[model samples]
Target: MMKLDPTNLHRIDEGPPSKLQRLIRRSRRRRPSTDATSRMAARLASAGVFAAEAPTSSGGPALLDGVRAGGATLRRLAFGVGGGALALVALGAAWSAWQERPADRMSDAVVAPTTADRTGPSALGTTAAVDSAAVPQPLSTIVPVVSVDELPSTRPGLVATSSTRTEVRSSSPPAPRRSESEFAIIKRAQDAVLSSPAQALDLAEQHARAFPTGELVQEREVVAVEALARLGRKAEAKSRANALLTRYPRTPYVVRLERALGEPLSPAPSTSGR
Candidate 1:
């Protein structure tokens, strides 16, 4: 080959070598030895381990501090929610208490009826007078005029005039005793109310003949009223109840009869009969 000019052989200001030439030169370079490669890998692994184990710049335990901060924040939130719920419940209870206050006050302020209420018939036609009349006549009559002097006296003085009067009255012939036949008839009438209402009617009619004006007669009439009603004699029952109410308006049984008849009777006694 001709002697190559230095300028041509050794280029000075040329751009980088072509891609193929650079690849060829790199392929010809010596590769590292196996031991040297392993040593280099160990050094790199040690550096990575040192970096992983390094302390934080903030001079604090980052994970533990973060966990403590989160726990404190959660506790505060829980406390706030619990307090709000408790406040709401307390407010609801307070509102309910406030709403009931007026009703409680009204109940406390209401007045109950006094003894004067016993003087007149109730809404259902009951009065102290009617209750008194239901007892046996002698006891009923004596209750209204009760006096301490009427009682058997322990003192020997003053002659016990009231006691003497009571004794004399007791010794006198008792008021005409009720006839046994009439009593038996009235009792039969009462008994017939459940078994034979028509027979009760017959017994009541017989009682009326014997003891026309007896108080027991009125009771028998009430029994007869019940029997008639049970027998589906509504018209007759109503009529008899009205007549009984008219005749003995002050009788204690009138209210019960009126209730059975499904009507309200006049509270005052009828003037025409009594």
Candidate 2:
């Protein structure tokens, strides 16, 4: 058992209370102890220099982000590039289409050489504008091609001569065989058929000699038959018409040949003569 002192009961000890003043820290600005200075400092390990730059920041901000951020940037760039390429492709296609169009080609009509010289970009623009503004003409009215000599002379002294003859020739155009078209030979014959039947027959004979089985063989036969009838050779015309009808049962030349001969190639369906 511990005994209590009679004097300590009144007081814990003999010492009075001391004042609690704030004590300034001695090592705030001072160097550490001798033992601490002697010991090795906590330092980062020397990294192996694989490249000039480290994974983390060196002195400045880090450039290439890790996989996720880099991939995101790359994706954005790829999308942008792809979009640009698509735009370029569409633009190029449109340009090619515009260039290939036949309507964009210069008109076949002979444009009289303009008095003013057209040299610059402005000339192209002006020409396009004029073409756009010009009203379209029908194929029959619109001359496809004309030479300078064939066109009427606007110059004072140059007289427009009647000798400037124009010729247009047609046939049921099949595939052309030669450079000199079958139309050329038949055209002359067709024109002369009305006025000069003898001449037309001569031309037809020429055509037969040149193109034995021509594309315009039907037209040639029709012309020959007409010429024969016009020249007062009914027997020859009838014989030729019969032969032609036999060869081509549905020959379109029947109407013209029948009219010229003033009779049917095949005998007319005999009416009810009862």
Candidate 3:
């Protein structure tokens, strides 16, 4: 309650604030400005660092380009494989078709008849007896049948008496010495050997049944035997040779057949009169 001098009291009341007091006052005033500054800094960082890079080109073209390149490569590979497979299939089918075709169809006309020569007697031999009708006219003209005594003894087994003229002893003409079809097949098969030995073998086998007792049967057997030997089928060649010897002992090819059988034929003696 003691009254001090007025000037001294005023100086004491107006004295400078302490450091801790200045800090409290300054914090209160700077709160809004600090918040605004923080917001500005956050906006700048987001714009510079977080924004997405501008696209150089749309992704559609890049994706489409990759797809196109892959598709082109795949298409090329598929086409190559498909074309090659198709070619192989086509070639196989063509070869099969060729193998199935008849040998005669592939041969020339003149050669076809020669192949027929290997087939035995015709149906006419079985049905009709030899007479003037069966006798070949040219041979009969050259050697008239005035009597049976004029006929050659070496004539083949088919002969018949004429009903019209009993005294005229005419014989049936010889059956064609060969089959037209068989000859054609054989000729073609022989020609085929020049190109394909395997095909020739197939043809020979197919035609063997038709010429069982033909004049050329022995020759055909020889051809078959040779073909088998050339193919390195020694067993088959030997078997064929044995069959030929058994069936046609008088075959001219007996020497070759015997040789193929591993037993060489003895040489024919000199025919000169000593």
Candidate 4:
């Protein structure tokens, strides 16, 4: 026998093998022995796992329907699990993006405001305090002020002399009065002279007897003369009137005497010297 090199085993193909090795290689190709996978299938068949002839209930049409339904159910379950896994992955990515946005916004909020505040530190304390003006009051009318001394009742008083707030007396004392009895008797006869001359003459005579030298005696005589003329006693009226004129030539009863006498009395002689 010749020795072969161990390091160069591929060179063995260069030499021809004996006849038995040739026969073994040819038989390996002709009728091959069982492989690892085929032997495992054979063992499972012997254990009756793949035996189709085992004696049990034979469901022909119903068994075929059950097999078809079970295959469709398993396919739907696989599709559902695949879709759910895809949805969960998408949701996780979106949640990570959403969580990052608020941090970015907070950083922007902290940094953006200082750039807009361009006014200096001098902007705060530049203004001074101020006071407001008072409201105006309403105007009133002017009242003339008068002095207390101006009132004759206040002997010695201040002389207030402005048109402000003054008060004064606006009235005076009344005139002196006359006697009622003596004046009234002659007055009644005077009022009655033309209407009731008879009553008037009687009242006149009563007055003369009562007040012979009364202050209103001239008026009484004038009333009596007018009463006499009214009673158609012209002669008596002329006589009393002449007596009246002779007593006081300047008597104010001259007009009454003339009216009763139905003629004018002669004017009194001139009292002034030439």
Candidate 5:
């Protein structure tokens, strides 16, 4: 340090400020103004919290979207399952209705002819309907008969009478009419069993009367039993079934007759007190 000169005695000397003092001065100059920061300070002071809002992830919104998607999928699955069940129920009901329909066939009834027409030419030929174009001609009309007198002959040994009697004798018997086959008749009666029970019964009786020892006797019996069952004649059906079983024990129609009678084809037990 040096002493002041006599001429500079009235002047004074000073040094620069330190680093800490300069930092304090700069911070004080950079602080925000009171008017701009007053509102945020007042809000924080009233709530008694100085902490800021924390940062968060998008997990909550993502979870909500996932839940909504799951619910929609479940709803669609339930609707599809319900629709399928309803369709199956409707299909079952239709099948049941179709299965429960009546067994009688109108076509069979119309195709089979009555018993009275069995001897007719139309029935003997075929079971088909008559054609309009192929009509048969009618029989020739009958003519009046006239008697003529014959003169006497002059022969020696033969003597001719004046009153002559006309004797008309047919040389040959009338031609035998063509008839229907036994199998065809039996089939017709059998076909009518379900549609027309009364006609089937009559045809069966006619068959028995016409051909007692026919090859299709067992089949005829079956038709009769079926017709009786259809007509609600349980007693008659049972009697017929018993008779058929007694006649033909090993016949193929035995099963049908048994089913119709609702029992076995065996004979009834002896109920005469042992």
Candidate 6:
């Protein structure tokens, strides 16, 4: 056995640390290294970050501004189109209102003629110096010029003026009409026009002389024209037809008369040769 020493014996008493204490020292030693490596990695990650991976703090405001601008532009476009449509509607309404104005319609309405337009100049202006003789009498009051046989009988009677005195008066009856009614005459002439042309012509002439202003004057003229044509009086027929054309250009008889006159004449066969 070796000789025992005091220093060696103290060193053995404080021999190598225990396993738990060694582990604690080792963890303490590794803590500063791990902290420094983590800080370095954080700085590197922040500094060397890619532009695509970078975060923008101001991006929220810029996106909101773009959206607001787009909305404002759309709002302005919508307002512009809506305003144009409203303006067109207003213009059309104004035009319709103007066209239907009552004053304008009243201006176009027909007005009746005044009494001055109907009355002649003599009846209107100079009534002061006008004579009763010159004043035209009504046609109903005028006694037509007729023969003595056509006139009615006259009766003479005495009319008392005051009770004591008597005045002699004569009352003549209404005159008898010699001319036939215009309608009857025109009908008779029309009935006789084709069958008895000479009699129709004579009746028509008589009607013209008797009732010059008759309502059936045109009918009488038509009957006369047909009768003259049937009687082979082409010259008189053509003359009367021309007069009818001048008077009643749009008459239905005009077409008939024109057709009759325009008929082609047939050629007569030679009697001596045949």
TM-score against truth, every candidate: 0.31, 0.35, 0.30, 0.32, 0.35, 0.32
lDDT tens readout by residue for model 2, 45-99: 0001111233455533111222123223222322333222121111211333323
Error of 1 at 166 (Å): 41
What TM-score does model 6 achieve against the real structure?
Answer: 0.32
How accurate locally is residue 221 in candidate 4, as Cα lDDT from 0 to 100? 80
- Residues 15-85, model 4: lDDT tens digits: 57967667766766753211222223222322224323433346432222222332222223223322221
Candidate 6, 229: how far from true, in Å? Answer: 0.6
Question: Per-model C-alpha lDDT, please?
Answer: 0.45, 0.44, 0.41, 0.45, 0.44, 0.43
Better of 1 and 4 by TM-score: 4
Between candidates 2 and 6, the lDDT winner? 2
- lDDT per residue, candidate 5, 136-230, as tens digits? 21112112222333233564453322221122112222334345445445656755676798998998988888778765677678779878988
Q: Mind sharing the TM-score for model 5? A: 0.35
Stretches of candidate 6 above 4 Å error?
1-178, 259-274
lDDT for model 5, please. 0.44
For residues 119-205, write the lDDT of model 1, one tens digit per residue: 232211123212222222343233233245555467445443556657655654333423343434554565566678899888888
Instruction: Specify the poorest-scoring 10-residue window by lDDT in model 4.
Output: 126-135
Distance from true position, residue 166, model 6, in Å? 32
After superposing candidate 4, which stretches have Cα over 4 Å from the reference? 1-180, 267-274
Could you give candidate 6's per-residue lDDT for residues 150-222 as a string of tens digits? 3446633523333212111113322333345454455467556656989989999988997787555666776
* Model 3 lDDT tens row, 1-274: 8587776564322457777667766766753322223223222221222112323245432212322332232223223332221111112112333234333213212222232233223321211211211232233333434446655589765354444134453344345433334434454454454356577777777677766554345545665775676677877876677676666565555654554445553333132111
